[model samples]
Target chain A: MMSLRSFRDPVLVALSLVALWQVLHHIAGDSAITAPAPTLTHLWEMIGQARFLPHLRETGLAFLQALAIACGGGILIGVVLGGHRLTGEVAEPILVGLYSVPKITLYPVILLLFGLGMPAKVAFGALHGIIPVVLFTMNAVRNVNRTYLRTGRTMRLAPMQTAWFILIPATLPEIFTGLRIGFSLTLLGTMLGELFASQRGLGFLLMTAIELNDVKTILAIAVLISAFAVLCNAALLAVDTRLHRGAAPETSGK
Target chain B: MKKATWIRTVFLVGALGALEVACRSGAIPATMVTAPSAMVTTLVKTMQSDEIGGHIEQTLSAVAIAMALSITGGFAIGFILNWFPVLRRAFAPFLAAYYAIPHFAFYPLLIVIFGLGSTPLIVLATLFAMVAMIVATMTGLDRVPRVLLKTARIHRLSLLDEIWRVRLPAAAPHLLSGLKLAVAYSFIGVIAGEFILSTSGIGHEIAFAYDNFDNPRMYALILFVLAIVTAFNMTVYAYERRLMRRRGI
Candidate 1:
């Protein structure tokens, strides 16, 4: 499926999209609708004025705090539950069922418990994120090839040594996969909390701009947020690829 | 396996019982945690009333429409990408990046463009659902073995015949998975949209109840949603399992 492709097609597609956008802007003049140029200019202005930083910092801090807890706790709990066959079997169905329920539905409960503040946002984000991390890590731990352990045992490796070298290496790829998914969910959960009831953050800014009908600023924020998502995902993907270097080819196509 | 099921059931029941006790004993504040019995009563009352029904209908319709559009649109987009490797290559990075961002963040712009109504909700849901569909469709179509195509050619099958008989079956499983994902995301997107801007729908009900501090109604609504989602998940899971069994997987 990975075919040799010309370098020009994306550039062509992007340019055509911009051209179409400009055409629409011309056709729909004088309304509050955001044109590409104005949105970009507003984005630049916001950045220059450093108005985006505080909100970005707030969002980032909450996300980081949640991610830290989710990664540490999720991995630990997942390993324990998944390492034992009996517990893994009992937990799998329950976890999957819980995961199916939209995590956002629990936002109200989080807000109620933690109130309309950073703690609520952080808890919400952590709750949303921990599921995928736990699920993936559990699966990775459970599905570690028996042959690897057998090999370790034959080599006279201690249980801990075997776990460190064999089990950990075997699960790293899936762990990375979970981390990536968990990170995205963490971002989503934090944003949802902010959108739901926060006094400040990117989501708050988006809501404010919406209320004011500031289409340009709204669009600008949208673009910036999308760019941020893209950038973070790219960075994570780079790290994931490095960690999974030898395994890339096998996992790539599907 | 039987022991596991028993254990799981007992655990669930025990947790519910604990919550009920906690709520009743005032260990947890009533405003924060509605008692289990109260939640049940509220659910029953809402079912008797048409108010909850209307919200359910609104939410379901939006989700249904969004799911349909995303499936069709995503299929087309995926096909186009499959047909053009260059475009796919160029767009791969952008596409991968989308997964990191919450699609709900774009709802404001959607509202600006589509105006305040189901239009924005449906559009947002479709966008959220369609990404997974597109990816699934691409991968599914890619899985159409060369041998099948060769056989179709050897049999002198028409394009439509080849697609219906050979390609569709080959891609069915992945497409089905995409459909499941689309369904889940559509529900999420529609609900989130309603919560943010809509004046109606179950999401609106939940938000309204939350704002009004109608703890029973809010808890009941959440339970209702959880029930609906869990039922949907079970159905999908059963269907997937059946398909797998049929394929001897």
Candidate 2:
């Protein structure tokens, strides 16, 4: 007799999870693998606390730097590859080869080359996350109407001229999509790097909390990080939507 | 042309060889960086070692299991969501936010909550990859030719039968593409998890090498990983291509 509206709400999901926790704990009692579900009051109390701000700034800076590097590198490479047919064809396979390799394996190499610092984290983030941007940008640029290019050539448009006036407008949607993924994965890479081996950043803080077994502090940091992630995601989506608002109807085909 | 292909291949080989030479000349200031032959030797030795084998097994199992579970779950959710497009419409923003957020950023929390072995890795992989799979599957279903569906109706196939035999078949390429992407995505997730959080895996080894500035070991491991991925891609491509050619897909 439950309302259909209650079927899949996040609230309902949380409730169900909590109930399952209670049931399991009641049956198996307590163990290292299981922690009794904390009441909402615990979460609220952590939210009400301070000292999580500096850690937030540390993670945010890394996230931002990583995003910038990935977006910049990916877009430049993507556009260059997309601009010329020969480069596109040659770069296509190499880029895929680079992309297909387990980037996680590159972490040690990146750290070795760049050393254990923000630069290493930034470079790792860019390498891990930039592949999607390159792929999508290449796709967007490649899909430019051949007729449009021919016409531009007939009109004596310089290569840059064509790129600025027509290609960017036509390819903005896909480029934005690529950037969005690029930024998200950049954040992921930076966090992973920090978590695995670092002296600073939100991930380092989280790891420290884990080692200390301070459940309240660990959950608080997590909540803050998740909230940051969600905010960054929303901002990226907004940028993506805004960039393509000029030409939406054309891409309804996709 | 064949000549162009050969040139590209030659250039790539030459560049890689040059990179090895640079490493050997000690021009890069990283002693761990070395020639391709050295990397090959390292890889060969590591593979022959039992500890390396165990590391590969641990990393591979996490990836394999996480991938299997995520694919099944993604496909199921995708099928259902596509069946009811209203759900997608209602939750597209939430979906965007979910995928947008660095799910890895939450891994530390997961490690805290789940106390990592494989559970957190699996959850993160499934969560990260399923969104793409579901979106792909839904898009595939959304593209089913209206005329074809009408024609099937005219032929009096049951609704359920049409879905099982026709719609699913029509969406096969997209679903497979989703699976292809999920392959890399899930592997990325598990590797990241193992690297950051676990003590026994390729990731852990990679992290150790990075910390120690063992550049040669790191490059060898990268080559080893790249080989595994290439093998996986070739197999999937061959299978998918053969399947497509058979079905006229």
Candidate 3:
């Protein structure tokens, strides 16, 4: 019923957008670029060709690899910093310092050092993905239950054992949240790297389409990118829900 | 705790400095890895040349104007959306879905429609940032407590008074969070815009440096951007702190 009502609400805006697109299509018809439908169709046709998959694979593989490295590195660093109060406090400001800087500025360095290949892209993506991962990991570690810690100590558990058995479980949920953010950023970083210089990748395709003024292909690829992002987000969210359910206390009612 | 903090700080800083030194002076080629000292020289040159300042100013001007415009626009739309649930039900999903849409892809379309430079850049930033404010304001207003509203209605309080005394203040925190996120989005939009096709701007500087393989110059720009962003973040942090203090938040 909610979806049905939602559908009823936007008919006018939808109609108006299409109408404006068509008007712009005809009135500014001086160049082939004026209309959106043809470009949209170009986007569609690009998908039907066999050439699309390679770039997608190249981009996705590089992104996934970078994300894994970043996740591990970020969480490890974050855990060490965030485990203690003063260190966490001091490190928080420093993280914020680095986070604000646009990572795109490092593209030249990455390309020069890593040689314009998937390695460069992966490194760039890892840098992009790591900051948030570190931030959230710190938060997760700081938020471990102190009372639980006292109980574990009372039971004569070794420090490492307590951390492994106690803190890790509690940190899982927030760590997952960080991973989600990091994963998205990894994609953005990889795409940006590819755009700067790549023999093969989605970013390369996007640039190619734009430079060629092939609006349709750009739109088609864009659709694929958006679909991929949504799919990734949904996948992360599913994992998050599962983790949340598993982490919940076995008993609820008094 | 203080000892831990000091240890971590010393370790991280020392590690970074060591790594930088290794990358710069070790077996790695100078062409491959620009030294920190070299990067500093590059930054100094860019500053002396006043080339990057113009670009920074251009980017900041767009971000400031776009953010201000969106704040007003978002507040208005959010209020209106709250006033009419019919509109809310209609537009909310579309807005939510598009929020995640990279829209960076359609950036070229923006260029097609609006041409090169500030118009497309500023407009895109505004559009991207505005949605959050609208959603935040709408949700905040919708969740206004029932009894106070009932009492106001029973007392026949004017709509203006009810909104000012009740809704606005109550919704302040959410609105501020929305505004903060909007600022981040605006920053992203400006950079992405410049990265894609702008003739000038900080993003253009990075792209050009990369194209030319000017590693030190690129590193300089990145550090400069980091400093600027850190400054922006402090401003927002201060603003948020002041608001919280004022509101007893």
Candidate 4:
């Protein structure tokens, strides 16, 4: 008998997918969309290769640099806008309108400005991630309980002290969510840059595989990117959960 | 209309004026920064020739089909999950993590299957939009008050009646937000696919301009796309606001 706790539906789903892959492989008879077994084996081979680390490092470094900019700059802008009543009211709708525009369209402009290099990739990633961070930060800062501000004032806290002690703590939970989403978007933007016109990175590798019609390599790269994204997201989510533990539970809405 | 609006207008104008000055003065290189004046003329000329119009129509149609497919598909999936606790439990972890995985990575796989053109574009957009909708629909449905559900049962309402009357209306706001996201995601996904694979569409045109280093045309096209997206967002936001007011939310 199967143990109840150990019985994950995903395991069954994964097995079924593998079975489906085998069936498709037999039916299609050596075309594109290679079977899972070969793809898995190829993935291992690719991972063992020397070129993998450089591409991974390039992607990783660009993402980190961009994420850093987005978080710091986004939070600062968010705080200012959220702290000021008139400024927030005046700017919020315009920001929202701008946010609706796909960041990918600006990729061309970025390439033109920064050229085919790490700077372009970083800018693109930062641009993609920054908007969500600012929006979330603005909302979080705006929603900080008034009583806390009152208490800070009662204690005669300085403006910086009030922001540091009262505002940041209260807003941490929502801002964490923003950072998580922002990081995901940054990764996406960097990959898009790499795919579109970069000489290096996982995206470039994927593009190369596509050009060659190398299905196994393409699948392997995709798996690598997906795994990276999932791991980063999971790590951030764990941090977010931990941060929320002692704080009053906040309602997280879209 | 308001003092704040006036201030915002002034602020925007001031920024634009500064940028214009910088561009004209060669503080920023001409190749890197197209003047707003240049962008306006380029946009008007492009519109007059109907060069941008065709691309807009293509994108709009793709988005419409994608939105329809995703919403319908998402609702079906969401309802099924709601009806089956075991399925929801089994799939929750996977579904939760799905958003982080850049769906574009699957484009290669899609290309292998569909070959190219509009089919992969629509499918990818549909997939992207559908995930957001599914999550939204599930959350919205999950939030339907237990009290109202109990009341429906107390009133001897049938399952269909309870779902149609009580559940859907209660979930409308959440669903609308999901719809908003689906629309945006669909637009983004379709454009991305077109950028990566298509022979035609605004995304393809933008890439063409970029390849040729046509700054004016590139800026104009980006602006045109931005305007369309903003219009869609504003309309959805207005509709959602009206619904919220109706529901006294």
Q: Native-vs-model 1 lDDT?
A: 0.82
DockQ of each: 0.53, 0.37, 0.39, 0.52
Q: Per-residue lDDT of A1-254 in model 4, one digit per residue for the tens?
A: 33453256756765786798778667655556678778889999987889788988898899899999999999999999998988898888777766667778888888888888899999999988898899999999998888788989999999999878988889998899888888877887888878888899888888888878787788777777777776676578668867877465544422
Candidate 1 residue-wise lDDT at A93: 88
Report the Cα RMSD per candidate: 3.3, 4.7, 5.2, 3.5
List candidate 2 segments past 4 Å from native.
Answer: A1-54, A149-165, A238-254, B1-7, B30-32, B99-120, B212-215, B242-249
Give lDDT per model, in order: 0.82, 0.73, 0.76, 0.83
Q: How many residue pairs clash in each candidate?
A: 0, 1, 4, 0
Residue A144 CA error for candidate 1 (Å)? 2.0
DockQ of 3: 0.39
Total clashing pairs in model 4: 0
Q: Rank the candidates by TM-score, best first.
A: 1, 4, 2, 3
Evaluated at residue B75, the lDDT of candidate 1 is 87
Angstrom error at residue A209, model 1: 1.1
TM-score of chain A of each: 0.86, 0.75, 0.77, 0.86
What is the lDDT for B127 in model 1? 88
Tell me how far the alpha carbon of residue A217 in candidate 2 is from the true structure, in angstroms, after superposition: 2.5
For model 1, the superposed segments whose C-alpha errors exceed 4 Å read A1-24, A27-32, A50-52, A241-245, A248-254, B141-167
